[model samples]
Target: MNPPVPLAKLLPVPKDLTGRLALAGGGLFLGQWFLGDLLHVPGGGLGVLLTGAGVWWLSRGSTPPRFQEPASLQGWIARCREVLDQFETLEPDGGVRRQQLDAVVQRSGPQRLALVCVDPATCPQQGELEQALAGAAPLTLSVARPLASAEGARTWPTVLQEQELILFSLAAPLLAEDLLWIQQLPEDQPTWLLVRSTAGESDRHCSESLLAQLPARWVDRVLVQRPDGLLRDVLQPLRRQLGAPIRNLQDTRQRLLRGLHQQWQADLEQVRRRRFQALQQRTQWIVAASVLASPLPSLDLLAVAVANGLMLREMGTLWGTDLQPDVLREAAGQLARAALAQGVVEWSSQMLLGLAKLDGGSWLVAGTMQAISAAYLTRVVGRSMADWLALNAGVDALDLERLKREAPVLVAKAAEQERLDWGGFMKQSQQWLLHATS
Candidate 1:
């Protein structure tokens, strides 16, 4: 299989050197003819220059915004690394890497610690627990008894509000009230659950059960205490769970930044796709406009055939297909025939006349009508080509007879669903034409 075309390659304005020179020269000659022949201008050379400049301006204006490649996952990771390096530089003494409990105490400034016990007898005494918690900043430790009674329930909320760090020691299965109390706790507060399974139960089961009962957001960390291990062992796991032991604020902010970058990348890709689709549609309209401007019979049809063929080929690149020229030509011819059979010329002409009346100009009426009709026909052709490409997989599999039969329905549907926005379409086409010349 062929490698997919990069979006950068797929989206740049079409390049046709011969066509560009032809248009520029034609525009210059026509400009002189109109100014010198019709309006009796004094200087023919100046008229030529002005016409060339106008053509250049129109092509430049029609050109789409420069394409930007989406940021890769590696790029995002590198950005994150840069941010981490900055954090490290700010705190050379490892101030940002402090333990979770220590960081909380330092940041919150001398706050109380509330330790809850499901079974009061199994929990360590306040003094012994306080001794284990002792570090650079001493914390005032208090034990909150389980919500076994109405009085216990009333005291739990007060204890939670008074403390910065609330640790729950599960020595028994949590009751409904215990789960409810944990759920009701303010999500902003840092709460930890330390599971100390009973003799008859499995520690993992107890941990899983307690986690399932409590809201995941309500608990900041879940620590599993080894039945025979030191309290210090639980501290390391707590720090890891907290993500940043030294600076919880900085750690949380870093995570949010990473998430924002990921979202931004996704959003950027979506915007690129939308813009490409709009450009693709505008290019089709430009071809139609060119066809409408032609006064000779069969010339507009020929333009439509050639323009739609090139448009389809470009679209094929987008769809990851390398369409053959013969296939594209045949497909274009089928679509052009369908447009003629469906009376698209008459319908589009009528629609253009309606638009011209709204603008109010007799001289512009014919040109405008032709331009819009071409746009309408080209739009129908593009849509049909897109459908054929999707259904048949490539131009090779296109059924010209079937496409001919289906073309009129597709045109009518597109006409009803999409109203012509000529102002923007014309502006884009002019820019594209000018860009091609340059």
Candidate 2:
């Protein structure tokens, strides 16, 4: 005979009774702190005592945790093996092999549930089948019936079809009340009903037809067996019960995940706003420093401004935000057209503003390709101004002239790099200028 498997290794005990008790006691103490001493209540001492009592009340249920052996998947494997060994004993030459059949059993609340069926039986493994029924957990061998009997095994199929609901027919006999206990459950709760009599007689039609009467969502799978020994169809009710709870839990988890995602998005937006503000402030400081060094004089500031706008196209590509290159190109074109119409040769803030308003310009342009490019130029101008201020506080006519001449070329290259539609950009620019001037 194979040696009995050790049960201790399969199940472990917990050992945190003291800590659990302390936590419970702490909660009570917190209540006293909140309600009595903090409020300067007359019965504060009484409240403290009551808090201690509350802790004691909670601790009454706290047992010192024991050190139990670890339970593993191997326990389930062993259980399966045990059922097989018992089956072979019942029928030495039984057509079924240990590998062919699987046994599953569940015990929850007051009922026992189990499943023992021929896995790949060409013919019924009658002897081993009887052994499986006999060896069910927590309930005695009841009955095994022939599958062919139309009125005999209807109840079996009604329960076994549920994929999630597990069953365990007990090794010990069950009373009628035990059968009624399981049968009385709402059709949605996965359950096992133990039958005591080994009699093969069962009202298959009644049991099966009654299953049809059950709510559609309540049924999963069912299994029926006679005391004599037989296989029945898989049941449906058990499956529904098993799947229902899991479905509800999944929905709850999904909602929690969505809420967390929204919170993360809000946090990211806040961080981005703070960083953008800091960058703007730092850029302004650099420009202030440059202006004190050498200032623009006798040069086309309007062209320089247009080139600065074009730089947005490059910054747009560098950063993945949808700061459009086309928009920046249009803005630059508008500045150029305004300069041309006004008989001005140089680009400047006033010339660009004449073409397009800058009222909400910072907000509208800051992240846009045009705005980013403008910001970059602002930085450069600021740095240059600071350097000039530090050197002599004098105007550099040559430097200003150089900036004006190079502005158009720089803007064109930036537009090309951004893949801007130059023709469309110019048209938009002209329209913008007309609106601005009007």
Candidate 3:
């Protein structure tokens, strides 16, 4: 890493814990004096503590402070790497992703797609539809019975090696529950729901309702079957939608490979996001608990530092970055400091109105407010740290100067986003308060 930015060049603000504490003490004194002397509020100590909490809460929105922009995208990523290197351990959960990627890479023969039918009774024969698109591949197509059958899952892989792809033609009406199950399939294959006409007023015409319940992303992947339309009529749009070649088995495999790779990447990203959220949530509550245990209930970074450091290390594990622990604490420290600078503690304490809604604002007893604020700050730090890890993946590391330049920007973005999501967070806090109180 490059030499740290010269102290003179740094922002002319409280840059150390001691200095900031001094500043906070000064603010508390001033507020106490204002409230007690000028405003004539009784109880000096109570007035001071309440004023301190109020000042921090009201001023929470004022920071994570902006900084000069990095020169380039790679530079920004590099800066993230530098900060992470000091505190992050690279260890991504790549085993599963690699196995899936290898499935795409090692397999040379036919690819597979699931053809689900909402009304099995009225669906056309699989061969007819295959024949309608004869030019799309070298005519070695076969249909599987049902995805619900004992042999359903192995059907695709165990198909003849000569076959380029075995389109699963499950001979069963896909119920809503089946739709839910299909979404969890590890194969993550593209599905085409065949919407045929009702089987002669047998109440099988509810394909529209089934289609609507699918996740919004899968809505357009349907193939509406008509009462009298030929199989060719069905093949026309399917081919166009997939941009399939009229003839060329090689081209078909390549197209399938590309689509598979894209889908697999999307699947991996979704997994990462979900896992990160789980980690953040777990870390936040842990920090909240620590805050409750600590004697000093005011906004102190100590409650979050250790827990957030572990969080950063785990996050690094998800990205396959092996970070050193001694150095990792430094990374968490940086983020914690950034969070405090951003007024996360005060921002979370802004729940004064929210507490009033919960049992006449009695939730402030025994430092409940501090515990929740600590949790909120932990969330902000973890979120910003996740972003840094994501961008730092596969990029070169940078100098200390660059990190100094970019760290605040990253934290600011996370703070702003968390602020927008405050409504949801407050609800979670409400539940936590009830649990703790109970």
Give candidate 3's TM-score: 0.43
Which candidate leads the pack in TM-score? 3
* Model 1: residues with Cα > 4 Å off, grouped in runs: 1-276, 279-282, 288-299, 358-363, 394-405, 420-438
Query: What TM-score, over all chains together, does every model reach?
Result: 0.32, 0.19, 0.43
Local accuracy by lDDT, each model: 0.51, 0.34, 0.53
Candidate topping lDDT: 3
Among all windows of ten consecutive residues in candidate 2, which has the lowest summed lDDT?
389-398
If the candidates were sorted by their lDDT against the true structure, best first, what order would they fall in?
3, 1, 2
List the candidates ranked by TM-score, beginning with the highest. Answer: 3, 1, 2
Count residue pairs with overlapping backbones in model 3. 21
Q: Write the per-residue lDDT of candidate 3 for residues 413-438, one digit (tens) a residue.
A: 99999989888987887787677658
Using TM-score as the yardstick, the better of models 1 and 2 is 1
Give the per-residue lDDT digits (tens) of candidate 1, residues 299-356: 4434554566567777655443455655555555445445444555555555555654
Q: Candidate 3, after superposition: displacement of residue 322 in Å?
A: 0.8
